[model samples]
Target: RSGEAAHSGSSGELVRVQSGHGHFVHLVYDTTPAHVISELRPSVWVRADRPGIQFLVRVVFPHVANPRTGKPVTRLLAGSTYTQQGSWQQLRVDDLPKLVQAAVRPMRSQLGSHIDVREPYLDRLVLNLYAGAGTTRIAIDDLDLPSAVAVGNATEMAGRAAQKRGPAESPARRRVELAGNVLQVDGQPFFPRMVEYQGESLNFLKGLGFNVVRLSGAPSDALLEEAKRAEMWLVCPPPVLKDEPADDAQDRPMVFDARYEPVLAWHFGQGLTSRNLEAVRRWVEQVRRADEDAARPLVCDPADDLAQYCRTINFGGILMLHRYLLGTSFEMADFGTWLRTRPRLGLAGMPVWATIETQYSRELCEQISLLSSGRAPEPAASLEQLQLMVQAALAAGVRGLCFASRSPLDAQDPATRARAMMLALINIELHAIRSWIAVGNVTPEIKAANTEGVNPGITGGVLQAGHARLLLPLWTGTGAQYVPDQLAGNLITFVVPGAPEDNTVYEVTVGGLRSLDRKRSVGGMHVVDDEFGPTSLVLLTNGIAVSAMNSGLPGAGQRAAQIERDLTAYRLARVQEIDRQLARVA
Candidate 1:
């Protein structure tokens, strides 16, 4: 309102700011049959530099009051659309703050539950609004605005950034591939922790079929050694701190008070600071000089200030937008807008990985694939959807996809739940690999030589569909007494409790099951009823069931197995058509 122009409303004369090249759109709706609250959407274009692209959108909720009382009535406020930069230009030192100020005003008005904000940097603004039964209005401008990037502009920019860094040996020599798929770090077809120096885990990973391993946060020399020996690629982030940060349990800080936020840790800030760029650059160089693999490039999770870091360093792998772009949140569109600037971020075809913390990402990806293919969810991970997502990502020209962590499983009490989490990871990884292969472009062999299919367990059967998608809850102490025996196509559930901290192992026994006739010794299938406290379950896959039995719990053993067996049989029966085809053809 400070910068305004005169305008005439039906009631009287009112002052409204000149929208400039910005246009306004309004979305009006209500939660109830008769929505009483009202909202407006304003779109403004501001020229910005550096990160590039400019367009500020604000959803304004005005205070509608009674004229006689001369007091406020209903409060209205929600989210805002941030202003972006002009293609290839950085925001002027002066213009940056004005754009930021415009974006934050509405958010501040409805603080607390109604208004929520996340300010990653001085120039970045994020507003979230939870509106109840209300009316909303929206408007979008630039319906016919010219596209910003020229056909060959990004290619030229990428060339310039690369030339500035001079020449490097190669990115592969520094590579280290972890064993198996997600959580199974050790066991057959996968080694636990690979050390190129010791080279144990790397060798195991080579057999399992992983081309690349991420040493993002706090990787040890052992990890590096494994990579060297396995001949698999490694993607590591530059060390932000000498040691792990104080809040190492989770790098994400929790905000008890939404209105007033706290500062990020020193390491997070340093990773984005100009002072640290040189160190990061030097680290990359050192890795390259040490061995051929070092040049493979290091990946960085520039969580807060990506633009600041990318402007300086020649990062090998740049995580563009963490959870959002990966479909972890409801911000896929915003993520796409941001990703359009990847060529500007200075890493062209260098691997770009997706990271997300919640289940939303996988769920959302499934949704996207379904929408694209007009399919509805049957159950569990779908090969069809995975294929679609992988195809879409590859078409977008991304180098690779990297999931968030192995830690999520570690946090479990070596119980049933922990085992379940590990199995989930394995399921996810398997789906991912299968999806990648479906595309027929980016092969899993980038990390291995002969890749029929990637092994995701210590020793598990070659993955086939129609398996009951079971839940493996990382077992906490207070459950049943014995683990369930499993047969082919049975789902197993386990849990890791909370965070990936507990390093416990649970053993279960499966008696009446046989691996399919075509496979080797029901690969790595074991259920040992060891008296190791409460029986815990770990390293589970989609086709097995953990009978509900341990200690202080309810039903155990045979009964649970009966239920699981019934469920597995039902699922396989549904896939009988495919089974018949395989039998006849094979």
Candidate 2:
């Protein structure tokens, strides 16, 4: 209906939308010829014919950076507070910049996303009117939104141009392939024990038994030399974005040059929220295009906990799951069945690495929101939780393990030293059975007795390594890091398939392998009565330890021998250090 407009130059017919069932209607306006939002606010005049009628103003920005994670965000909401019934009233938001910054944090918490929020490019302004029941009409005009000097807006052309990827003219020395959830590099099964690079001595981290280190960016020649000397691999990180999504994907193929031999894989989307998932697809398409030979498999952190949505996601070959809340009963409903739904997630043949990282609980996120307004969230996780976290992920089918927390292993904090030692121990243990993890058939389900020694909290899986099978049983404890002492003495059942009565079972700890009391139960099941605590054991393995190398990879045995030699020394040193840290912390 043509009606008188609000106080403006021309009194012409205004636009209107009909409503039904108290629906939300939005009137969107393109924010072209807009300013940089330095010191401006939006105002609108709204006239309501009914008492319950409400109106709101929202503006969307294409590139509001989440300061902590350094990713862009979109959308802002504001409204009027005047209560004069049925009269024209003006609504304004004075603190637009501050609101933009503070608003993103709660969304991060609500979404359980690990994004950190900055420079905002306000894209569009919208006039929102919530209509009441039985057709309530509201008129809104003079929607003066964030007016200032014109600013340059980013276009999509340059972003798309950037995605063309770098030239790969250099001679490719080796090929990287994914063979049924195992990473095959240079024709060898590569089971990575990874950690974030924190400026620690390269030899120090290597001595701690880490096979791969995720670098901040492309590795320098000197850093490459150090990695080569340490017999370790380096993972390159993706370029950070500052604008629109598509063309933003265009720059940098992650590595400086395609010929960098030490550059093992490219790391993608760490500390990103689910909001930026679309960005991930664009990034992957660009990066995957760059790695034409597919010699460099991407190690992806698939957007923190994506339980909120069941969208199919893409990855850089390997799936590095950030199941940080494993020890705490955070009840990640997605993760509760996440590993079970792996194949359904189109991850049937992809290698998966789970992170112990920091056990980020809801309380911790709340505290970070309420108490601190700074970077660096206080560490809420403990060593005991980290120990159990390792157990749970390993017991599942994680071929690799990463300390995704920034500077976790190298920090001088007392707890951090203990964490480093604990991780070192686990790294050494994983190294001990690297082949089994790298190529063994992962059976994430092992039968456990309902009564007798086994309890409900006890769950584990089997890894069939040629002549022997490894049984890993872990105690998935409560959210508060407290557990009954009896959880340590839980019983686990393993099947000795086609084995004679003389078949022997062995228990593996971080220290070494040992013989345990094996009792046979019904159906050829050997019930092992042992203490399965949070801070002990690699797994239970049958004797003859790994049958003839089932690894068809050429020279797999020789490579394993070399890795084993280094791992044994690291394990010995770490176990000894664990004792020292234990005494020191005590």
Candidate 3:
């Protein structure tokens, strides 16, 4: 019977039924005009409002007219009896083969176990809701049976199929070494200033001073050769396999023993299926045989068992954790330290890499909306904010920095252009100081007496790279009720209270460098305004100081012009070097 269903009733009609033997109601859907069954999952929302009722829900797929005989045949799809009462339930019949087998028990012996059920034909989907002996009621509403291709499942199936196809040729393996927080390729210190871009123009990346390109999956052989010629390294993840269960026995428990603990952990933790584990095994073997020298590590998120498993297999890859800028400085520091101190589940220590997105945080995004009231608010990551995040990670001693986003690097849009410029500037500085930054150990907390009156938000640390020690002072504009103007001109001091009689100290700023006298103070202390603009300041006794000599320093007109000329010459030399490398590859 059709009527308005109670319990938050609406104008829509609902199927009302009384509990009795052979008392049933069904809705038939035709798949003749369009082959709807071939594309979409036929589903209906059912509600058993009355308690203490027993019902059997069966989805029937009647046979279509045989193309040769033009006769209608009987075909059973799926049937299930329900007793428990619940809220609105979604009954979806997507697994047609399994459902068909469960429905037709008598034909099981004749058709055998592996019958192909993908044939597209005119059929009828009949949803039968039957009530058992009891005083009960059922309502059916919101039936969304459509005729279209199942894009989601199709895409997944395609990906699984692709994983079965191995690379045509073996990849050449490269030697990768990690020594004390630094990664070296072929015995040379390799600082990965990477960019995630899909563009083919390596020239842009070269000009931006990036040394690595990170791809989601394996690159083509041609692309690999091109990257080799460009003097850049490629980082890619292993192919993901389908997730199939370890065993098909329904009676067995899902848990595994300690020997299978790693697999089980990976299966549940990383959401890997048995099929995926098999694929990973195959991919690892292929990498081991074909490209022993390549740094083809199986990249994964931070998980103990997963890390242990990879290490056990001698997979040399880094654990990349994203979404860094969302937390407070202390929280970030704690996370970084935790990552560094985690037990080495692998044979060798794995590098900890953190990702930074060049966009506003979710909270900030929502706040923008609330603050704007109705109008659209401008969303962005200020240059100062980006610098704060990168420095924090560096201070935490991350081996690699992974810049992530799908935003087009070559786009003409303003936001994209701004983000690209910010990345380039940051990378330029990193590329310049990578030698010092790569080897330096991060001193999480620096105890200096002179920094008492500095901005409370300002934090300082020292990076000890060899005999030279560089000071890193950072200020994240967090926990302040109001933005202080003085923050833009905050002063950071590095105090060495002992008599370093012969050591020379230089205050390095973005604009240029200036020398400091050792005898000026009791021992020696160098002070400089924490230039909170587009540049960073480092107090160092050694290494080349990076500066914007051409733009902002005073009394450096002639010096700035000379530096500009030198930069022009350097750019030209880089272009010529690229040409030379490309020619050699050709």
Candidate 4:
């Protein structure tokens, strides 16, 4: 919603607002800094048709910025107010300079009340009231701008202004950044084994091998503390105005909130849908002022691969891909086409990640019909199918991975642990070869072939990591096979061109990597052969990565005597912690 006011409209002086999700209404007097001779004492009568409607009076000056810190300056001078059960409540911010100064550094260049014309020359005062989910009718009277008047069609002007405005730019050199196509965290290559938090213990998730957790809404203090204790990163939502106020001594939105170290990135936007894309863009423009100097990158939600509308929407810098194909109605070639042209998307050296989960599955199109008929689903994806999907997303060239949201694959169902355990094991595998997987580039020179003729489904690709070549052979299963049957004992030969004969080759598998036997083809290509099953992972790396796996992985018969001695103690401590909880459901 634009807070830019139309000096006069057919609606006369009373500006009525109909606001909802992705919508806002406001009163504004857009003026040049020369005309800004202190009408900052903003007072307005706010009344909803219904009582108890929450309202806010934020004085927005879109073009305003602090001269000292180079941060955008927006005001919540008039704290928050409520419509008194259909009665009018006059909200006012008496000492505008005090509250505004308290919230931000003075934009007046020097101290005192003198306005500086040299720095960010604009004084467009906006009295904005945003909506929650549903629409609310708000009536405003007694527009109080001494130097100017409120625009009647402020909302209309805002929509247009937001359209003209490109997405906000975030400061560079974030905690998470990109080196080539690889994601670097604090100057180190980072492969985030991320899973959407689904009411699981933070310690449990950390122990299970997830380094990053996703939260749909703003996390609580306890949750942040727990994540810190668990030593995990978070993909979280931006803190809302409802939680923190401007008057609080210890709390400040722009500066203090920037210190949330556990937060890796902020996610916003309407996910895969485009109905509210414009409104979301507008909201981003206004909300970005609160996080002007914030460091972390912002990511959009459920980015639509079909429409790719999220590319047009502003999410700071980081944009995610949403082309999910391994599940129902998998299309290898069409999906691969998009992945291949990804680098040309002009991300400007920013790291790109993909949401590889059931949240954007084609099957949802049938059950929920969120997608078009062109994006169809037939056979369901099984566990083996999932394994191949992971291999494809990484091998096809995605930097990092965020696991499914509200997905059974991401869920840790106490009753059903097989799928969760398998995913955890896959995370373990991804972490092992992350050295190459994070920064490797896909090349057509590397190839894999089955001994028993060419298996159309079981194929592989080579990753050209610096000085090291990694090969991932996936049995993706061709034809109408949704979940293909296991093909065991068949030998697959992988050939990597232009590698030395004495390359230290290793095979990365679930939980660890093992040294593999390498042979040279008659044509002088590096070749490694291994027998694998349907769900088996065949990842071979040549001469770069070190083997971290112990050779002491015991067989089933010898495993009983080698179980961890602290298993029982750990279990007892866990049970005690559960019992000590405030609300024990049991």
Candidate 5:
């Protein structure tokens, strides 16, 4: 017999037994019955003395009490054979269910009655290790008995494994395709009318006529399932890592200890260390595995490195340019510069999305200060300011719009209520013309013909989608950080080269089509004055006149008849004023 220990066991003893032909060592542990019920297939790690050392490990259950009868039962709960020798090899009991069934079959046969062996109260676990010929020693340690819940969640474990590998593209289950500046689902042009706020259910969005929701991060499995049930598409932004290194002071790579914060903070400018790259790769894989139909866009500032990284990851070919924190003037200039210089970043073909802040100035400042070290200089844009931003982006050919607000929608204060109404109206209008907006080809910049005394901030553009042509004229408030009340009522004019064709009728309406004027064209170029308050507009087309009234406040929809009546009243008043001016001139 060799007294020298092969490996240290859990009992701090070197378990070595010698027999010319074969030998066995038995270790027993008294455990509560609940432990056995919790862990179905417990396992332990063992090491053999040398290669090709044949051994058998079994877990014996003794003094198990039958639930129906008070009799004790002895059975082999689990067992495994070790043919290969190595350091710390795991011995897992195979076919536990079959073994339990086999043990119960004989008990039933002897008693001549059906015996329920499912819930057996186990009293002890006897671990036995048997060595084959020429085997001298074995070492065992680290017994693990995991609960049934842990054992059943193999899918989550597989998802984690997939994260280690690069993200795999699943077969198109929902069939959402991005083809040349257009989004199509199931072969139909789909315009994503998306809400950016997070909510418990998508019922509110559906009520507002939105078809998609944009989330800052990946939604949970339960939320994704719920969205699928609600028939709404989701656009999930990739985790936006902080620009600085994980350890800003030491400039060391970030340690991904937190669940998702570290990974999300990985972005461009920061050198792509192995950890950062791994984190990004894992994030992509995790999102892909979570929901195949969800669109994943990288939320990043306009930068060459970020664009390159996005392209490398094969992201959903869309990059959201977030400029909401910056004031309106800066945002407009930044958007224009990025749109023009996108090709320089190797993002020529990718579409860029814009975010609209829906908070008041004070609230915006508070939120921005909290996010940064009190360095954010700009306040949040108001409802009209946000409208101007959206219109300008649209004129500059942005592909999508996201209304951003940190506050929840359930807030019923006056400001929040007004914001909700405005958002609802915007959504209604966007949903109505989403198909056209999604596929429209933008024309060159359209400037005011007579800017002699007009607001220099006025800008216009044209979008031609199929047979529908939309002329968008936007008037940004006077170049002031805080817009004056007088600036809200500026008048901007658009010059239509010629009137509509014989069969076409000129339909003019508000920004959200809240008001409408359906009238035959005069067949000549004419200048139309647009009241720049609330970002409303005049839409002229060959279709029936559909008008929407702004109500100035939120949540009000206008009927066609009401819009027609309002248009007549306003036009008549304007004509009378013009006549008075002409008479005074004479």
Candidate 6:
């Protein structure tokens, strides 16, 4: 709730807050450069009429406690630039700090010093409190910031200003790729929510030079049309999970049940309802008939419940799905073996993807490859398992290998999560990008082999038509911080701004790429040149950028834009190299 000051309100001298969803509040304030703000604690008092003391207040700021770093920032006091806390309990005057009491004193006591007036410019303050029944009071005894001054209604006013600032740009949307005749929507490699609003997503992507948007799940037809309209590519999957199970007489599991819920939720989340399934089937046919040249591929989920439905779901689209999660059990192995022996099942293609068992582990790499190859090694197998999977997938004449998220829920912040997801996507798509890198080079073939395998893979109908693809998802719900250190490789299924499961490729050229003084951004893919070597620049191509670039002289901003253009060209060259290698191997 907005920490506004109003006289004669209940819980006199205490900001009245309720308990429910969206219960958390935020406090925003300005600080002097020198004060070095730290631990701040605010007291929350309950109304005399309430059953018990109902509120606990604590300081909140943009900064978060860094456990890995040394001791947490300790400098703090009652009156800090920003302060917030959460609790279901109602607060009384005595429970609050002197600053809060003074601010609201007109409604209650008139005995103390007038509430310190925080500078209006510095007055932007917010007090975010989370309240609910049962557990009522929680207070922060300490925090850190500079020049503590509690301003009334300062938090809400500042929060509104911040909201107007809009969402932060994602790092994944920066790079541009000129794919053959068409451009790939190059922005954040893949985001789930983008599949729902494909048009706006693709337009946003294309506007920023993204070459492809991997259309996952059951995106609406309009979404696909938007991608096509934006001249972007899509990687689609079928909707087989929509069909009723063979045994309708059996009781269905709840949405939370791991066995059935994930798939059902995913299907439902994709907006695929029972009544609309037929309509979707027809649309799938239409997509196939209309754009044979750039039709998106149909990918599938490997969950057990979705097995037999693959055929029905595939709906004439290229079949792709992960192998590792399909199952690591002996029963799964036997079932896979039997299924492979079938003639009809053989008709469809299986593009394999490997996920890290944990974080970055050699065992994960090996196991992923092994599972992709069509062999079922021992469950809980390590790197050795990957080799077997890869071989099996290859033997089955599968399309190719996809590397998905490495650490899915690792990041706490939503923005940081978006960055991680983007990085992973970029890494996995290296094969595709490398293809374009090989173009225009005199000795392309030799370089290509060194990068992408001479042959990418073999598809049932068209070898290149249904080449292997990678899916990188930005997990939502993580707390996101606009940390510069994560901008580079933030594509690995991490987080994005507004789109819950989408990512935006950050433009590194335009913005002066900077990171936390001690930390480093994901540098796994940064190409360094000693002298005249590679450079990193953050780019922006939104309406603001276009307007700024066109009107401004060739000054600092223009130079940044130029750097963006140059860096994109350089990256594209590298990507072409990978593409050529895939073609060579293919």
lDDT of all the models against the reference? 0.29, 0.55, 0.48, 0.52, 0.48, 0.29
Write one digit per residue (lDDT tens) for candidate 3, span 165-253.
33342322344566544676545566677777576465556544567777765455566556756656666653243233346565332
Q: Please write out the lDDT profile of model 1 over residues 263-318, one tens digit for every residue.
A: 01011222244556666555545443432322233355564445555543343333
Which scores greater on lDDT, model 3 or model 4?
Answer: 4
**lDDT tens digits, residues 1-586, model 5?**
1223223432523466543211224566655342234246666666766432222223222233332223244564545545466566667754555656656654665433543343443344555543422244666566655553222333333344334323453322434556775656544556665566557356555544557676666456666666766666666654333344554666543332212211111122123434355556665555444334344333443333555555644555555555543344554434444554553464566665666666644655777788978854344344455555666667667777766666665464534544555565566556545545777777665555343646455555666665455666566444433452343333345554443543232323332343332333343334345344434444445443222222211211222222234334544765686688789879
Candidate 5 backbone overlaps, count: 16
| Position 169, candidate 6: lDDT | 21
Candidate 4 similarity to native, TM-score = 0.54
* lDDT at position 4, candidate 1: 22
Off by over 4 Å in 6: 1-232, 237-297, 302-316, 323-429, 432-586
Best by TM-score: 4
lDDT pick, better of 1 and 3? 3
lDDT per residue for candidate 6 within 143-208, as digits (tens), equals 233334555554454454344334452211112222331222222122121112123345543322
Q: Which of the predicted structures, 2 or 4, would earn the higher TM-score when compared with the native? A: 4
Model 2 misplaced stretches (Cα beyond 4 Å) = 1-174, 216-222, 238-259, 271-282, 304-316, 326-337, 359-380, 447-456, 480-487, 490-502, 519-521, 535-586
The prediction achieving the highest lDDT against the true structure is: 2
RMSD of each: 26.0, 27.3, 28.0, 24.0, 27.9, 22.2
Kindly give the stretch of ten consecutive residues in candidate 2 with the minimal lDDT sum: 548-557
The 10 consecutive residues of candidate 3 with the worst lDDT sum are: 259-268
Encode model 4's per-residue lDDT on 1-586: one tens digit a residue: 2222222332323334543111123456655332222454545556665433232335444333333223444443443345474666766545444455444443342223443222122244455544332245666555554444344443443344343334463322235654555666756677777887877777666645678988888788888878767778888777753334468865644442534667777666425455656655554554466655544566665433423433443344566666556444655433444555654544445456766653335455465444544433233344455555676677677777877755434243331243454455566556556766778877763445666656545566677666667676655445312445554545666666766676666654442445566678765454545665543444444422443222212111111111121233434664676676635555
With a 3 Å backbone cut-off (N, CA, C), the pairs that clash in candidate 4 are: 2-158, 5-151, 6-151, 51-85
